[model samples]
Target chain A: MAGEVKFGILSCANIARTLISAMKLLPEVKIHAIASRSLDKVQSFAAANDVPKETKLYGSYEELLDDDEVDALYVPLPTGLHVEWVLKAAAKKKHILIEKPPAHTVKELDVMLEALQKNGLQYMDGTMWMHHPRTHKMEAVLHDSSTIGRICEVHSTFNYSAEVAYRRKGGLSADVRGNPNLDGLGALGDIGWYCVRGILWAYDYEMPKSVTAHPGASYNEKGVIVSCGATFVWEDGRTATFTTSFNTGHVMKLLVVGVNGSLENDDFVLPARADRAGFKVVSNTSWKDVLGGWNRTEDVQEVTLEIPQEAHMVREFARLVASIRDGSGAVEPRWAEISRKTQVLLDAVKESIENGLKTIDV
Target chain B: MAGEVKFGILSCANIARTLISAMKLLPEVKIHAIASRSLDKVQSFAAANDVPKETKLYGSYEELLDDDEVDALYVPLPTGLHVEWVLKAAAKKKHILIEKPPAHTVKELDVMLEALQKNGLQYMDGTMWMHHPRTHKMEAVLHDSSTIGRICEVHSTFNYSAEVAYRRKGGLSADVRGNPNLDGLGALGDIGWYCVRGILWAYDYEMPKSVTAHPGASYNEKGVIVSCGATFVWEDGRTATFTTSFNTGHVMKLLVVGVNGSLENDDFVLPARADRAGFKVVSNTSWKDVLGGWNRTEDVQEVTLEIPQEAHMVREFARLVASIRDGSGAVEPRWAEISRKTQVLLDAVKESIENGLKTIDV
Candidate 1:
């Protein structure tokens, strides 16, 4: 790996696995250290994985946060624990990649964002699917003016079988998703946030001025709310509505309907989707992207889609780390900002659902 | 038009004009007479349209309703007036096609249904687009099973531009669209009802168990409601969410996304959109009646679609009339029950919105 960026990960969580696998495939990055709360746990993880800096056991999270060799911190804790760790990492001057649902509420997110800027630390939100090359291709294809029509409405959805939708040890219910105190926010926070973020990314992403929702009512055995929905309105008079449910079956999709035509896609469960005769441009994001399905007669065009063997998030993260170390520009800096806004909107929606879905000023 | 069905309209309104133009397109039907409360209006309309038999004139709606010569009724009056006319037409044993937002509440809808059955009268809700050729193609593509995946979720939207949405002078909003006294229901009934009806048409008549909504508090300057929304769950575990706005710039859309792929279309509007890949199809509804899109797709294997002309609605309406006389199976008869159910669900939603969105029994 020439001119490589040395990276150290602090957990053996799913997100850690995603990052490590991607690191394995890239030449511009190297795994330097593996840390865990227990020395034995860290040693086993390091043994199966390649890390030049060996296994470092930290009985306390503070030890890892204070380690100077760790140029960036990857926090994949529960949604409830994000702010506490993000601020701790920011204080140590480490660049951060916090997993989705960056915080339980915007107030918590505000604290984390404030700390990042105050410490002059570079930061990014780890909303994985956003980094996919398909997203870039969609953005470009949708912006193809030759096809005609501005997108007037965006309809995004992702439903799941209620049983499989439940949290690690629980059943599917609104309490699991709606209780900000328990799940930090439910369906939208976990995956739907990505759907909404995808819409913003595909569009120029001007924030909506007003948001209100009619979310499904979810309840745990003890009776707590866990499911709901929210709609937002943009200034130029476009509207975006989203639904996140733990009680429904598998759905991972985002649809952007334009006046002239429409485009859509899904990640994790489904690939990119769009009207075949409208437009299909080359992938724009630095990841594997594919596009094809056209009608040459009516001037409709398409491009062949390509998917890299590795996950898109991993690819983008490695590049981001390398850019920082080499003093180069960010690979996709807007991702972090989009993630922030997505989080903020999700937080407001939670409030709207909790307080009778009142229209909130975005 | 020898021995053919003679169509005599009961209003001088826009929808009546549409029906008149539509009947003109149907060789099996003829606009024999038009009755209004004002003879001057009738004479002017008759003279301008060159009708050989305008039935002179009628100063009262009952005179028109009791006319032995008129076989069926197409009631496109104020929303508040739908129930009364439906009951009268049914009692008279006239096959009836009433404008949507059939009644202001579920109780009214139930009574209307009961009346139609009690009198052995055939009935149809004028959701003409459900029978559009392109809609038929869209349905076929959705159920193609070969391309579309398991149905995930459906998001249906129908909005008309504020300035162009309603009855201007003695318009329906003040007389029918949103006035509980006239329109009988708000956004859901006036336009959103079609979305609900479309879903039933798309999903082979699968019905949701419970419904909920969060209606906007927006009102036109003259006190007409301009927007509202609802989210419903089917007993089979599928979920549906819909929105209808009269204040926004005009737009109408219907989207069905499945596990492997999806179906996208704006069948009501010209330049009808069709289908896209990677979107799933969960509905049991066959593509037997699916509509085609504007231009054909080059990759016809996965991207099939149908486009229709504006007269599509005219042709569909004529089918309803032919179905009653020629018995062509009642113009998608199953939709009548769905429309009644939709009205009930809408009533419950309105009650919920007024009471902080409390969940109501279906």
Candidate 2:
């Protein structure tokens, strides 16, 4: 709080590259330290991302956790290692910015949350888009009873065609996403996390009554899901469906239909343009032409982004960490609560898929 | 066979107003006659559309069917009356252009198909978009294999909010879509018809192996579905989901995600503009930046429409009828088959819904 929120990087994952660059853009945040199992990977990542000379480099995560200069930590490790490192960082009293699929399971997330709360450490996931100015604007519309009305149906998808040269050249079985000892949850954890989060965000994070996985889940040779879909049902009859894949062309879309209006965007997960983000809204529709087709008015609301979404996420997390450090704020349970609901929904979907698309109560 | 194809219209349904106008746009088609049980309704309809004075007007459908000058008939009557009038029109050896949900049930559609085939009369359902030049272009991309690649998933939806002054004043119980006795299938028959057709079109008419209805289907007091969704699964693991509603803001979208690429348009059921229609395609996408987000290269392919899709439909139907009349061609049979397949899928969805979201084979 007195100087800056000094952050420590816990892994050298590919996502860490972008995240570290994003964190560097914030004047109130400093890269205090970086650590990786392989010292060479840590040195290369720090060099490529322009980590300052004063930033400590460590060959082991334990050394980074022991650094008293670090005020916060960012975890971009694989799902399997999240619980171990998250608990260690929490015990060190470092505010945390953890990557998605916050933990391998809801129980693991519970442990991480308990540790953070007991230590009075701030916690937030790396769902960068949630901090974007566009998201707040979209949320205003979705929450306004006059604009989007009551949510009736939501459909979200996040997919990318990963059947490219690298996939073929590397022979996917050994890929981190496909490796059982690494990110064993596969595409469901990697991408479907966004889809499930999108649905929960649209409905104000109210968990669904039940979830049912759809058929056609494709898995790799190592039995990690590469593609999957599911349906969520609420007690009020509102329903949502989402699909995610690593086997199709890149597509990230969210469509929310309501009784009075609707909101939609093709780049819900990642804004197509970094400088600007927008979503289309429609309202007061009726039958206009003789063809019995509809007549609805649409308006594109754009939000100018002075700082990229990832940077905004880092700034938000840093602000929360600074507030807690200065005794001006308590940890916001909202972020971790949202992540847990998303994890619970994902677990239900996976269980339903394992049970052959049977209905599973959330 | 001669100068023009004569079309007799049975019923003064609102859709006939559009169909009659579309037919009038075709040079080789004539609005030869009009009929309704209420003579005043028929007279008003003819006058409102400026029907040629030479065109006959009848107080009853039987009179129009008996007219020897009428070579073909377009039936836009309510679903409850489709079978009765279709059989009578077939008995008159009139080529038929029937409205969608050509029958209340698949069995009813079978009866009408048999009548048309037995009578050796050409038949085509009024699914106007099928004849759109834009459709032909989109089909080329979807089927090219090199462009959209093999279809992996399809998502389609068609919904419109019925909250206008007229609807409020009329209170909607008497509206055909909400009236079980008139259009029993409600949103499923009226809008889901297009969604199912879009999927079938993408797959080149290969019927899905199974369909499972989703929960949250809204129904009217008479037990007519006002909103519904279903998932279609193919033997090859391809999947499709469709949602339709009469209680939401207008939305018409078809998204086709493939292994190599994707094709999508916001106005798949109805082109946003009549003059030109376009769909966005993306392929061979990769990360162009270091944001850890994908960079999908998109191209908007536009197809000019010389005539409205509805007019194109009329012209195509007239051309087929002319060929049959001149002895240069037999009935196409293709249009009828497509309608039947759509009906079969609709029936399966309805059965799945009735059975509590149980999977039903097509």
Measured over the true interface residues after superposition, the C-alpha RMSD of each candidate is 14.4, 2.5
Assess every candidate by TM-score: 0.69, 0.96
Q: Relative to the unseen true structure, what is the C-alpha lDDT of residue A232 in candidate 1, on a scale of 0 to 100?
A: 75
Candidate 1 Cα lDDT to native: 0.59
- Over B1-362, each residue of candidate 2 has an lDDT whose tens digit, in order, gives 36699999998888888887677778899889999997898898888877789888999999999999899999898888988898998899999998887877899999999999999998899888898897898888887898768888899999876434237547445678778888899889988999999999988899989998877788977788888888899997788989898777778889999887789887877776677888899876665465645566788999887678889988988888999899998999999899999999999999988997888988
Chain A TM-score from candidate 1? 0.79
Best by DockQ: 2
The lDDT per prediction is: 0.59, 0.86
List, residue by residue over A1-362, the lDDT tens digit for candidate 2. Answer: 35699999998887888887787788899988999997898888788877789888999999999999899999988888888898888888888898887876798889999999999888899998899999999999998999878898899988876556247557456567777667877889988999999999999998899998877788998888888889899998888999898877777999999987789988887887788878999887666566434566788999988778999999999988888888888888898889899999999999988996888988
Q: What digit string (tens of lDDT, one per residue) describes model 1 on residues B140-242? A: 6767766555564577777654343343644434444556577645666767777777665656666667666654435554555566667776765566787
DockQ of candidate 1 against the true complex: 0.10
